[model samples]
Structure formats: C-alpha cells, structure tokens
Target: MEKHSNVKSRRKHISPVFHLQTKKEEDQHITKEVIKSVRRTGQLNLSSRHIATVPEKLFSIYDAEDENTVDWDFGKPKKEEDAWWNINPLSHLDLSSNVLSEIPAQIGMFQDLLVLNVIFGIII
Candidate 1:
C-alpha cells in the first residue's frame, strides 16, 4: 500500500498561502495604507465602490493634530526650499457614484476644496 506523495504535498503548499491572514486583517491593512497615502498627498479618489457612507478618516484627517494625520501648513517657514509643506494644500476631491444619503458637514473643513463631483448618487 503506497501513498501518493505529490497529492499530499499539493495541499501543504496551497493551505499556507490562503490561511495567512483573515478578512478583517486584510481590510485593516488596506485602510492603513489609504490613510498613509492621503496624509501625504492630501487627495483621494474613492469612486464607483458602492460605498454607503463616507469614510470617517476623510473628515478627521483635515483637523487631525496628531502625528498620524497630515497637518497641511503650506505657508509656514521652512528651512528646505523644496519641502512638501511649502506646496499647495489639497484642492480637489471626487466622490462619485456612491450611495451617499447626504454630504457630511465635516467637508467644510477642507478649506482648499475647489472641485467636488457627486453624480448618480442619492444625496439628501
């Protein structure tokens, strides 16, 4: 009675890859990455995702005083000539095709918001 070694090896190889992380862990990782990028660029495009509500991070990011969020101080004194803070603040945001019931009041915090697009979505 000889067992097939190849069949057993296949299961061992595939199980580890799929069982590496849970769904919650993956979602947290993605959220963290998005926050990091938004802090640096001050711009975000979350369109056509069928999101029911806006991410809370978008509202708090503008006023976040901690080290995690970006404090966009564009006109402050800088020793470096090409510092990122010296650049212009966030000026645009696109939240289209999402099932948003109403625009959040926190949007007003974005003083640099010049253009906003919310088409084909429920807005109250």
Candidate 2:
C-alpha cells in the first residue's frame, strides 16, 4: 500500500510537455513563397508545420497579389499564358502531421480542392 502511494505521488510531479507557439510564430509557416507555389502547382503541402489554425490567405490565395503582378516588366510584352488568371487553382491541400484543433469554415471556399489530407493530426 505504501509503495503504491509513493508511485502515485511521483507520477503527480511529472507533467507532460507541450510546444506552444505565439500567433506570429504560427503564421510564419505560411509565407508568400508558399502561396505562390501553391497557386502555380494547385497543391499545398503544409504538413508538419505545427500550425493550429489555417491562415486566411491560404483560403483566398487566388485573389492575393503575387510577384507576377507586382514585378511585371513594362519593357517587355507579357505572355498570355503567364498571366495571373492563368495560374492553377488550389486543388490539393495536405495538412497532415499538424496540430490543428478544428478546420476553419473558410475551407469550404476550396471548391476545386480534390484532396485534403489531414492524416496524423488532431482535429477536434
């Protein structure tokens, strides 16, 4: 009985450790470069980014200004195929291996999304 009590007391002092991030830290995982790639490829792999919440920009990346819009060369004529409107729409989103608690309602905006891999993550 004394041994059981001592074991229980020892376990009480041992608390599980968790890695918490600030709002800025969590948002840092999603950058302009990442958005650009996703827009071009139509696939976003945000796995293992430790993000608790999905960034709003991820949902509306098609409307967001990108390098092509801002850094256009006026000296040369632009190609029609390279236009921002020609970019591929986001279709595949991989949010696996993350710490997401709940998927945002904005995710529904991804009408073109074909694959949303949320495996190995906590969504509750």
Candidate 3:
C-alpha cells in the first residue's frame, strides 16, 4: 500500500502534461533568443537547430524601418576601426538543415539579400 501511494504521488508530481508544457516553453525561449540575436547582428545561423517553422520576426525585421532606411555603402573603403553599424543590410541568411516545410511569402522583404541557404530542409 505504501509503494502504491508513493507511485501515485510521483505520478502527480511528474505528469506528461507538465513535461509537454515545459518543452513548449523551452522552445519559445530558444526562438526568442534566436530572433533577438539575428535582429541585432543581422545574421542568423540556425543550421542543424531542428527549427520546424520560420518565425515571423525573421521576415519583418525591416518593416518598421522602411521610411527611415539608412544608405549603407557596401562599396566604400573601410577603416580598420570602423564600427559594425556600417555593415550592409542583412544579405545572407542560413537556414540549412532545419525542418522548415516552406519558405514564407514574406521572404520577398529581403530584396537585397544575396544568399539564402535552405539546403536539406523539409521538402514540403
């Protein structure tokens, strides 16, 4: 009877429902970090990260700045101490080896994007 009670208590404390919720929370946290980092650095390397869906933030990072777009000169000579703020617009995006089933239509926002690596992602 004591063993059965202990098992019942453990079951209550370690339910599969709790585990599923925790997993969803963790995935959201990771996705937030990825979006924040990519927005700040203008680069995202999510290769082999098991990402299933392309987040919306990745597609709309430039929408708010449409009217205030800065003209970054990618052809100008750069000094050794030049700040990274002069870097060109996000030109390369690597989404290789992820689980992405489709490239969203919002991808058209990246007009200046030069390279988009979606190698080995989901065929659908």
Candidate 4:
C-alpha cells in the first residue's frame, strides 16, 4: 500500500482591492465604541467566545461588590425574543453580593445593564 500526499504545497493567491465610499456613508458604517476596563480578578474566567469580537459594537457593565462568578462577570446578556439590543451595549456588570433593602432609582445610570447580579447577604 502506498501513502498518498494529498497536501498542496502552494500558497493561496491574494488580491489587493479597494472600494471608494462617501465620507457620510463611511461614517455611518462605523459603530460607536464603549469604554473598556481590564479586570484581573482571580475567580472569573474568560468565555470561549468574546462579545468584543462580535461584528457590531459591544459595551460592558459591572457590579461594584462582586468578586466571584464568571458568567455574570464577563459578558452581557443577549436581547430576549421580545426585548431588543440597545444602541449602547452593556457587556459587563458586577452587581454581586451587595444586596440592599431596595435598589435605588439611580440604577438607571447603567443604561446597558446586561449582567445585573443581586446577591443577598446573611445578616447574622
């Protein structure tokens, strides 16, 4: 029996192409970017896929009082069947373990609150 060398050794060809566009159209095509912050928390792990890599723009919101929890700490939630994605994406949030008697009306500051964690604490 002979082994077949099926691998092609040639590198694929490439073409350098450029398309013309109007300034207004080009500006419209570009999506606005949200502020990003790098976190070094030990417990949180990166997701297999990142929203940042999505074709469209994405943003993040975080709970101030959380330390553990990956899914809640990393990415923003997708819009539900009825709900829709917001113009400003809220990708990260850390509303962890800082439970209060009531959530403040000011919570609306986080316009894109995709990951909102509300952990109740033991008061013993």
Q: Which ten residues in a row have the lowest lDDT in candidate 3?
A: 17-26
Can you give the TM-score per candidate against the true fold? 0.52, 0.69, 0.50, 0.24
Model 4 stretches astray by more than 4 angstroms:
1-90, 122-124
Cα distance off (Å), candidate 4, residue 97: 2.2
Better of 1 and 4 by lDDT: 1
Any runs in candidate 2 off by more than 4 Å, and if so which?
Answer: 1-18, 66-82
The candidate that wins on lDDT is 2
Decide which is better by TM-score, 1 or 2: 2
| Candidate closest to the true structure, highest TM-score | 2
lDDT of 2: 0.78
| Runs of candidate 1 exceeding 4 Å displacement | 1-30, 62-88
Question: Residue by residue across 81-108, what tens digits does model 4's lDDT show?
Answer: 2122322344344333331234445556
- In the range 2-29, model 3's lDDT, one tens digit per residue, is 9999998888887442222233432553
Q: Per-residue lDDT for 41-100 in model 2, tens only? A: 899888887777776557556774655657547554376544666688889999998788
Question: Model 3, stretches more than 4 Å misplaced?
Answer: 1-41, 63-87
Clashing pairs in 2: none
Model 3, position 77: C-alpha lDDT score: 39
**How much is 55 displaced in model 2, in angstroms?**
2.0
Candidates' lDDT values, in order?
A: 0.60, 0.78, 0.62, 0.31
In order of listing, the candidates' clash counts read: 0, 0, 0, 10
